[model samples]
Every structure is written in structure tokens, then in C-alpha cells.
Target: MSDAAPLRIPLRPLARILHAREKGENPDAIERENLRLRHEEMRDRARVRAEGRILVLGAVFTLAFLTIGVKMWMVAESEPAEPRTSFAGAGIVAQRGDIVDRQGRVLATNLDTYALYAHPHQMVEPERAAEELVEIFPDLDQERLLKDFTGSRRFVWIRRKISPEQRQAVHDMGEPGLLFGPREMRLYPNGAIAAHVLGGAGYGEEGVAAAEIKGTAGVERAFDDYLTDPANGGKPLELSLDLTVQAAAEEVLYGGMRLMNAKGATSILMDAHTGEIISLVSLPDFDPNDRPNPPTEGHPDDSPLFNRAVQGVYELGSTLKIFAAAQALDLGIVGTDTMVDIRGPIRWGRHTIKDFHWYGKELSVADIIIKSSNIGTARLAEGIGINLQKQFLANLGLFEATPVELSEAPSGAPLIQKNWSELTTMTVSFGHGMSISPLHLAAAYATIANDGKRVRPTLLRQTGPQDGPQVISAAAARQSQRLLRQVVTEGTASFADIDFYSIAGKTGTADKPKPTGGYYNDKTISTFASMFPAHDPQYVLIVTLDEAVETSGDEPRRTAGWTAVPVAAELVTRIGPLLGLRPEIAPVPLADITLTSN
Candidate 1:
């Protein structure tokens, strides 16, 4: 670098200074003036440098302000959102509680996974990404996926959830646009088991990082708020179902449905006293893990999602007969020994009531029930009078839907005749003229098994009896229990009577009514409402078969005794021990033993 040039200064002629000195005049003023000029030059240079530094600092400040202003504008124009997993201040809940059986077995739970989303503009290989994704999930259409990947969409959802393997597969494609959002999805570990009770869950709120899961039906839907409540601290919702019992029941029911060639079937095993359901099975069933959409074009029953036990109402046939006899006995209008005239075809206008078989001219009230004499039951209903009969049925909870903890419970409200004529009274005595769900029948039978205490059925585990309203005298309930025992031992339900287990119940076979007309002679809804050890009942099981026919005989028998009874017998044989209901009528043999401590 070159050095700065020296500042120009006016110089007095050396001659003049020298001449002044030589004339003996002092030249000190000339020397002092030169020194002052040099000082002035140094001050001017410092001022210019200071001004230059000030200007540079001002430019730097301006640039910083401009950069900040642009950034603020961009941020103001962008959309605002919160992270998906955090909904604390938001009204919606993000996490869901687990559902478990009474035995603490998980029925439904959550799985940590990733949600696949896309930023189309950031894609490096849109076609390859679409091809690979379609390969990973055949359900995806390649063309649609490719279009979505290459289109103007800045963000698009690829899949609601992806397994780790799938996420890795997509990650391997090296596409910058394909991204994963962390989320939890509903998972049913025991596939298709207790499908009806669990109902199902589906996605609610959607985001790239997280998603919301909400119950769509069944207990999941019934307890939606409770399951999602933050105050619950994620405690599992325990149900009345025993997983082992439920699995056994489903297997038996499914096999029975197939063997009987029935269209569908349902079974409910409930605690006679506590009203807690041990196992409720409805088949054909679906896996809640991948729930099917509700059918839009057929009968609701056509859908596997339909909960038959809680939703399907049928003329439960002679299961309703027990209610009449108990009511009559409770009212003191009859005794077990009282004789009832079982005359043929008791006429009531256009319709006539008759027993499935002739019981002669007269049969004792005990025999009336033992033989399942519909005529006798109808006569008892007539004697009970319409108002008292209605009151009695309502007290037994047959008039309303069960208060069971399920979303479908309310829809099971019994179908009652609007007119409720005398004929209606007679038919209803034998489980006709009114339609009720099998669950209702189970509860009614539970009343008898529970010694006449009207119980409100529930899906939650209970510690003891419901101790609901007393609908009938304990004596009447005992008498009814004896009659039901006699039915199994000596009448239509003889097929189910096991000497060791001591089964008791009534057989019901009702002709299915046609959509356009009265009834179909061939198609019948057969049911068996039974309790174990009639002498001292513990549980009431109601098993119903839809259009079941046992064809091993010369003719296709469609009675509950032929179909529902045998299935129930098998179930009792299988699950009775699980319920701690051992078949050994004899007491456990004692053995010699010694006590020791480790």
C-alpha cells in the first residue's frame, strides 16, 4: 500500500525569512504560523474518518430493520396451528383410555404409529413414491396417489396410520415430501372376540403429527366421554365380561349357528342377582380392529355390526309364559296345585290360543308350566286381567329396553301392540303379540332366578346383587323355578336336562312373520331361557337361534328344544366350571394334609 501524500502548505519564501533575520529583526512569528498550519491539517483528517464510520453504522441498522420487516410479513401471512398431540387448552381430547374385561384383559387399546402425509411441492420422485406406496397398500390407487403427489397440493394425507415397516419403506424412497406424523390408533388385540360389546373406534380430529380416536358404537360409544375424560387419569374402563367365558361362548355360539344352519344367533349369560353379564355373544361378528361400515341398502341385521342380543327384538315365545304364571302365583290367584282347564283352541275373535300339544281337559298349574301349555298360560293371563298383566310385565322390565350399558340398548325396546286387546293379552302370555330382545328375556328369567327381585341389567362389573324392585313374591319365584325345572326334566327342554348340572328353562319356537303378511311357517326364532340348579339358581342364560333347523331327524325340527336347548347345554357344560359352577352335585371329597410354611 502506498503512503498518504503530505498536505500542501503556503511557505514563506526562505529568502524573506532569512533576510528578516539578517536585518536583525526576529523571525519567530513566521515559524509559529507554520506550526499552526500543521495542527489544522491533522484535525480535518480526523473529522472525515469519524463521519465515514457514522455513515457505515447507519447503513448496517437500515439493513437489519428491512430483514426483520420482511420476516414478520411472511410469518403474519402463514396459517396458524397447534401440535396435534397437545389439546390441553383445546376443547377436544387427544388421548383415549383403554377398555378391558372384568378380568383385566385388554379388549381395545392404542398403538403408537405414524401418519403418512405429503408435501407435493417438495417431492423428488413423485411417480416412484406413488408406485411404492401402492405396493405397500394395495387399497391405494396408483393413479390417484400419483396425481395427489404431483398436483398443486402443498400437503396431503397419505395414510391415517403406518406401521414402522411401512414408514421405513416410504423413507427408503428418499422422497423429501413424504413425512410421518406421530399418532396413536385404536387396536383390538383379541381379534373379533366380543366384537359386538366393544363396537369400534374411528379417527376423529386429523393432523400431520397426531389424530383423535373416538368410539363409534357399542360400549366404546356408550362411554365416550368417560373414556376420553382427562380427569380419569387414563384408568381402564372395566366391563362385566370375563374374557375366557366370552371366548368360549362365542365359539359355542358360532358352532351352534353353523350346525343348526341358522341365519344368525345371540346368547347372553348374566348374573341372576347382580344383573352383571358374564358373556354376551352375537354372531356373525366382525373385528373391531378393522370395523366394517354399516350396510346402507339391506336390513340392518344383514350387517355384522348389528348387536343381536341388545338390538334384535323377537317374539321370545314361551319364555314370556313364565312371567304370566309367576304373576298369577304372586297375585294369589293360583297355587302350584290349582287345576287349569287346558281346553283346545280357546277362541278370542279371529285368533285362538292352544298348547303346542294337547294337555287334556285339565292340568294343574304346575303341569301347565311343566308341559309348557300355552293354553293354560293364556288362561292364566286372562284371569290376571289386562291391567294387572301389563303392570306385571312392566315390573319385570319386558315393557322397556334394558338399561344395559351399551349404545344399542335403547333400540331394543320391546314391540308392544298399540291396541293391546284381550287377544293381545292372551298371546303375550305365551311370548307372542309382543317382541323383546333376548337380553330382556335374560333379565326376566334372572328375576325368577334371583328370587323375584326385578334387576336392571348392566355391563359394568358389580360386587353384589342389584337389589332392584321386588316384582314377585319369593314364594312365587320359587314355584316358577320348580316349574321351569319340571319343564327341563319332563317337557320340551328335556334335551337340556343334565342330572349333574340340573338345568331348568323353557323352550320357545315362534314363527317368523313375513314382511308382507302374517308369518312364515318354516322360519322360526327358537329360544331357550334357562337357569342352572333350579333348586338354587345362580345364573340365567338366554340363548336364541334365528331360523334354526336341526335336520338329523326325518323332519327338520325347528323348536328351541331341538336347536337352542342343545347349544345352551353345550355352553353350560363348557362354561359352568369356568363360572365356578361345578357339575359334581356331591360335595368335594376331603383329604388328609399337613400345613407347612417356607
Candidate 2:
């Protein structure tokens, strides 16, 4: 009813037309219907494609925003960059490797210190600043500093290696000319503990550009390249040293030296089998941290800088009698109980060899060792002859400088007798007419301890068994150990006997030879060379005191038995437990163990 025109087509006619189009009976009507259907299908496909593109655009936008958001979050979580320090003006930036003990304890390291330099022209109040600085550093030469400040000099070193507190103080004072630069100061945490071994580093050529430090002596000099190598990158160079044992030995030796008022002292503790040095102390030691300036007037021959253990050459007195007796026994020249006639002093040229403690007209080799009979021992060496005696000492590594890993060797060649005469053989047997370092004597003793194997002394740790040659038969060494034990149990080195440990050793008291001629009777080099748990020695020690005076004690005496022996006893007592050796309250006597001939 609402239509403008009435519905004209009948349902039957429309249905007829659609049927004809499907059947293609009416050509025009079929083409029009097919065209319309195709157009509608194309429109629907286009709409689907447009919708897919829109979805893709939305995803791209989301991903872009997400990436930006994540980057912002990461930036927020990160730390702020530090302002880079400009070391452009700094002269020196020393970065040396660290030196550590066997246990990784830092022995030597670099400290970040500062050095002060002055630009005289830039200074505001030259006089006032100098006075203030002098007050702050009392050791500074006020006169020299004042002169430097007032002078027209452009650059001058006010101080090298200033402390942090001092730097802050100077900064507070607001000194204009005083500018601080970064520096590395060589620091020794243990002070004078291993001073001789560590030596020291001193500033090399000084200038305004780069500050350099050079190793002048000791291990510092010996291992300079390794320490300063950039590839090492401050990595620790480990040494074969035990701080506790070293400290104990030093304490005992120092105490003894003080008690005896000795000029100087030297002590060494080494592994008997490996020769790895555990401790090497030379008393009157200067602090490597604060090395004393070289003397301008006199030679530093007697200074603390001298490493006496490996450097000092001396006639090692009656201790050499042990070697002489060993030579006699090892060469089948004599046995432990072989009788030696000691009727009187043995005459060889002008020198007459005499024993301080004579036993009798005839004494066995064991009794001669116990009584420290010089005449009897000399006759034993005389029977061995000059060539055999020399060869035996040579085999023990005593005819030359000891193969120790120290710079002391080149400067301290062993003073061997040039003329190996009959007189030389006799005197050398009683520990006279030749000179060697305490290290040489120690190695000889170690040979007697290590089943007759003589290992070279070493400062470096051994990763494997040290290569060495046997100097004497194991039987001879065992016999020698028994003889040495007798000397400690019943003879001159009785003072060195520690109740818990089986200590075996010999004492040497030699007159110090004068620079002008013969020997100084007043001054004696007292030495004690020993091995502990003597039956199977693990450690060997050598202690020496130069020009020691028995100034105090209930019964004061300057002999090795009185001075160096007590030091050895004290050391062995304290360090035995540290070395995992339990105390034996009741020790076995040397006489109980008999040496049967092989």
C-alpha cells in the first residue's frame, strides 16, 4: 500500500525467467545475472585483502613501539658512566707484578701513591707554601725547598711518593704550584723480613715525561724482566718461602746476635732433599721498603746490603772436620773407631795444627769428632792426601761458588787454595787455608743428610724431584750422620741439641783473617751447620755470627757452641711442630745405633 506503483511482475513469470537464466534459455537475462554475481564476488575478495593489510600495519606499529620501550628500560637499569681521569699530565704509571710467598701472601706489591711537582712561576705564595710543606713533611730539606721555590725554575720535584693523607693536606692548603700526579711505590708488607731476597726497586732516570723504576739488586734485579713484563699484568710471582718459619728463624737469630753483640749474622733454612730455600736471613738487614742510600765515602762491604749467607767467604773452622772424617771413612782410609795418634800438635811447614780440646795420645775417629780434635782430623786429611781432599770437597760442591739462585754468586766466588800443597791439605782439613760461603758449607752438610746426594740450593719451588748426583755412598752418609749426632749428643755442638728432635751438627769457630796479614784472634766467625730429625733429615740449617762478642749471659763465651748453637736449638724447637714434626720427649741416643760395615 505504501508503494508508489503497484507490483507488476508476477511470481510465476520471475521464477520462469530465473529458471531460463540458469538453463541459458534466455541469453540476455543469463549474461546480466552472471555479470552481477561475478562483480559481487570480486568486491568481497577486495574487502578481505584490505582488512588483512590493516592488521599487518597495526602489528608493525606495535613492534616498533615495543622495541623503543625495551631500549629505554635497559638504559634506565644501567649505571652512569664514570668521568674518565685524564692521566695525560702524569709522568709515571708503573704497574709491576706482585711478589707473593708460597702461601699466596703478598710480600711485595705496588701502592697507588702520588708524587708532588712544582711549577715555581705558578705559585701564589712561594715562601709561605714552602714553610707549610716543610712543616707537613719534617724530613724535607727546608733550605733546599725554599731555594727551589724562590728560584726561576719552571719545574722541580717537591717530593716523590707522598701518602694519601699528605696529598689531602696539601690540597686543603690550596697550594697552586704543587700539583700531584699518579705514582706507583714499591711496597714491602713484611718490611725487612726478606730484604736480601727481595732487594728493592729505585727510581731510574728522572724527568718531566715518564717516571721509570729499575731493579738494582736481589730478586728484583734477577727477575726484573719477568716482574715488569706487561703480559704478566700484575700477576703474582710466587716464591718458595714460608713466612712463619722465616719469622721464627729470624727472631731466634736476631735474639742470639743481640745477646752476643755480633757484628752481623746469617741463617739459612733449606729443604735437605730438594735444596728449596725456605728461609735465608742475614741480620743487620736493612728494610727493602726504606733502602739506605749508598755510602759516598767508603765501600759498602760491611753494610747490611751485603748478603752474608751467600756473599761472605770465611774459613768455616772445625765444621769442615765433618767432611774430612767423611772423606776418610768414605774412601776406606778409616772407620768410625779407627785409631788416630794425637800425641802433640801436627807440624806442617811453619803452621802447627793443634786442637782446642785434645782427647788423648790415641783416639778413635768417633772420639776425635766428639772432642773436635783438629790435629787428629788434620792427620786424617793428610792420609787422604792433597789431591783426594780437593777432589772430595770438589765433589761436595765446595771448590766453587754455590749454585744458589741469587745475585750474590757472581760477587762471591769461593776462594779455593791455588796451591794444593801438603801443608794446604793439612790446614784445610782442620777448616783453615781456604774460604767458602755459608751456603757452600750448607750444601756440603745437605749432601751428608740427603743420602749423599748434593742438590744445588734454589730459591724457586720445585714442582718435581730435583736432579742431583750422589756425592758419597748412602752407608757413608749414614755413618757421617751418626758421627755428627755424636758431636751434638756428646761433643762441641751439645748446646744445639733439642730434646724433642734428633739434631745432628758440627760447630765452627774460626779466627777472622785480618786485611793486613794473618788472622784476628779477638774476632771469630762462629757457625753451626745442622740437620734435624737427623736419622732421616727433612731440613738443613746453617747459622753464622761474624765477630760475635759474649757481652752477657751467666757464663759468657764467644764460641759457636755458646752463640750460634743456641740459636739453632731455639729455631729447631719452635719450627719442628710447624713442619709437622711431633715432639719426642725421650729421644734415641746416637750411641744406641751402631754403624756396621757394608
Candidate 3:
């Protein structure tokens, strides 16, 4: 029974068993499912890993970017800051002190101004900027502006000391790189009236010329240090020169020059008691503001820039007779009663000294001075001896420049070298060989007017009496004054006399030295040195003309009386009233000092 059953094992039973086995789970099917689930898990893990890698990469990139930014900022912070270009925050420009005349008139002053500059690198469009700039400043070259703009240089100057209108116009252009610098500008409002005394200003309104405008030629250059003190920024420089007086002097000098057709002229007025320069004029003067302008040309070939009062040197001719009389009296070599025989010409070795007007008889010392006798002067100088004469001349400042508050070349005195040959002594005695500046002559005359105390001439007003070394005795000075008065009242300086005041002075005409030694026969320098109110002197005035030419009259000869004396008279007459000196009645006894022909 078992064999039959097994064989027939019911194909149904076997099918049922196989179906149960498949439904319950075959091992291989289970395994395959597990493997698929595991594969899916592995794929999920791989996707997570790729996402993590992407996040890491992003973090690394961000860190790198941050490091670079931090480094750049550090470098920027470490660099040095640039220097400031504007002068505003730096400091205010110091103002220079004012310059005024004795009468309180302003002579020099400073004005506020702006200077223009540019930073080329800051300009965005250089060509357009330059064009705009040229429009504002027509003087500026477009090509130059473009070149300057494109240049590597950061800063450059456009213009210095521009006016307010010009500065505003430049600012209105809205130039990006343009800048304005603060500055000051010096101004001389009086123009050329006192140009010789008021020197010019420099860049940045600094005092460079004329020693701080003390007296560049006449007084500015002389008192430069006093006028300009960097520590003090300068104090007010009050001068003895009165503007009204200076103007009057200039007018007279200019008129005289024009009328005489003179090449050049100079005039000076000083207080006899104090040796203060009241008014001084150098003809053909240039405007201090227009210092760049070329000097006036043509004439006796005179240089307007030259200060004849202090710079020019000349033989003073008969004017030396004043000093001769002073020296003779001072040395006790002669007195008013002392007499000297005057012949036609006195022969001294090879040179013969002659007088323009020969007395041909005995003449007193007073007569010699009034007549301006060259022969008489030579005799007096010879009696005084060379050494004594040299000392006298030196004491009178003839050997050196007049010690004023101005720069000056020393007077050309051959006596300084002490080359006293007979001819040299005789020629110097008559003012032929020795040369002195007009300023020197003026100062010497002032000493006589002030009664022999040689006060140093000053352009600055004296706060008190001037202190200086005395050069001559009062008695000698009185005698010299008396002799000088005689000359003006009746001698060569008659033209200098004024009706209101008794004037005393001497006239001089010396032949100009030739280029090849000796003196030119025709060319001459004419001079007049005088003092007003001769009895009690108040002012000393001097006038000089270089190679003046006479344009009128039958005789075209230029003489001291015709060329220089008239200028002196006009200046004294015009300036006296302005200087607080009034016209008064002439004293009776003092008028007795008139020259008389023996």
C-alpha cells in the first residue's frame, strides 16, 4: 500500500506543497529582496556623502574669500596718510606792519588775495579740464595745461596772487582738481612818487628787495633790518618823509628836468636840525609796482633806476668850497678876515688850478667861498695840509657813504686812498678829483646848518634827538654857514634864493670824466646844495643833474645855476609849507651875510 501511495502521492498534494512553499517564502527570493533593500540603503548613503562634499567645498571657498578681504583691509589701514595741500589749516599768513609818512599817510600796505593751484591726477578728463581752465585764464597755454595734467606730478601752480574776481571766476568753473591757496599781496598806492624809497615785494608777499622797504635806494634799503623783523612780522615804519613834501619835490624835479631837457636829476630835502630826509626825488623814477617795466630811455643817457642821491658819484666842483672854508676855519688856517692872493691861475707843478671868475687881487676867506674861487680853495687846502684836509673830509662823511638808513656806495673821495700828490690835493680842494654822492653833500650841509654836530641822516622819523659823533666845532660850523649864506645871496647860487626865506647854498659844475682818463671838455654834472632860512637854518636841500643839456636860450650850455639851482628853489618853495615851515619875515642882521666883490 505504501508504494502505490507514494507513486500516486497525489499530484494534487505535491502541487499544494509546492504552492505553500512559494507563498511562505523561498530562501532565494528572500535573499534577493534583502539585497535590493541593501542596495537602496547604499544608494541613499552615497547621495548623503555627495551632499556633504558639496557643503565642504562651499565652506572652503567662503573661508578663502574672507581671508583675502581681511588682508586687503589690513594693508589699507597700514598705509600712511597723505600730506595736506591747503594752507588754511596750516596757519594764518602773518600780516606785515604798515609804512607811514611823518604826516600819517600810508605808504605801503598788504592786501588779501588767493593763489590758484591744481592736482592733475584728480582731474577726470584732462583735455576738457584744460580747455575750461584756458577759458578762465586766457594767458594759460592749452597745450601746456594738457601736458601738466597728464604728467605724473600730483600738484602744480596755476597762478599766484589772483584778484578776487579772477579767483571767483576760476571757482565758478567747477573744476574738480582746482584748488585755492591763501596769500597776501603788497601794494604801493602812491605809484612812482616815492619809488626810490619804497622797494618792491616778492613772491608770497615776502620782503626781498630794498631791505624790507626801508630805503632800497634812498631810505628803504638803508633801514631794511629795522623795517623787517621776521620775529615781529614787522612794525610800522614811520618815515620823516612827508608825502605832500615828497610829491612837491617830485613835481619840481620832474618839471625842472622837462624844462631843461636834462638827462636825469635828483633832489633831496632834509631837516637841518635833525638830519631827517623830508623829501627826496630821483627823476625818471619807475613805479615800484611796475618794477618789471623797463627804465625810461634817451637823454643825457641817465639811468632812472640809479639813485643819484646815494649811488651816483661825481666831482662836486665849486660846492667843495663850502667844505674848504669850514676846514680852513676849523683848523685855524684862516678866518673871515684871512686873505689869499688870487691871480688868474695858480701853477702847482704841471697842473694849474684856475677860478671861473678871477678876482686878480687879494680876497678874504669869505670872498673865496662866495665867489667859489678854485684857486683860493686850493691855497686854503694846501695851508691846511693833506692829512688835516683828509681828516676833515672824512669827518664830514666824504670818505664813505652817508650813514643813513639806506644802502649806498661810499662817496668817491681820492683822499680815502691818500694819494695826495700836489695835483690830487689841488684838484680835490676844488672838487675836481674827489667825488661825493649828492646825499653826502646834503648831509655835510645839514651838519653846518645844525651847527657842526654831524647827525646821521635818517629817512625814519626820530622819536627823540638823534645821537651821533660830533665832527666839527660849533664856531667853525657858524662860520661855514655864514660863508654859504653869502654864496646864495650874491654868488653862484643866486637862483636858489627865495623871497619868503633867506636861502644859503653853493652851486657846482664839474666836467664828467672821460672813459680814457681826464675830464670831457663839454659834458658836465650840475649841482646845487642849499639850506633855507640861513640865519636859523631849518632845512637843507640838494639838487643834481647828470650831463644836463640846455634846450633854451642862445647859450645852450648847462650850468649849475641854470640846471640844478632852479630845481632846488622850486622844491624848497613847494615843500616848506607842507613841512610845517611857514613863510616868515626875513631877519635884518642875518641878511648881512651877502658876498661882496673886493
Ten contiguous residues minimizing lDDT sum, candidate 1: 82-91
Each candidate's clash count? 0, 0, 11
Global lDDT of each model? 0.88, 0.84, 0.76
**Can you tell me which runs of candidate 3 are displaced by over 4 Å?**
1-93, 124-143, 204-234, 293-303, 408-418, 467-470, 515-517, 586-598
lDDT tens string, model 2, 346-411? 776676777786577989999888888888888898789978888888998888877676766777
TM-score of 3: 0.75
Arranged by TM-score with the best first, the candidates are: 1, 2, 3
- lDDT score of residue 157 within candidate 3: 81
Candidate 3 lDDT for residue 197: 74
Q: How does candidate 3 score on lDDT?
A: 0.76
Question: What is candidate 2's local distance difference test score?
Answer: 0.84
lDDT of 1: 0.88
lDDT string, candidate 1, 172-261, tens digits: 888888888888999999999999999999888776666778899999999988888767778999999999999999999999999999
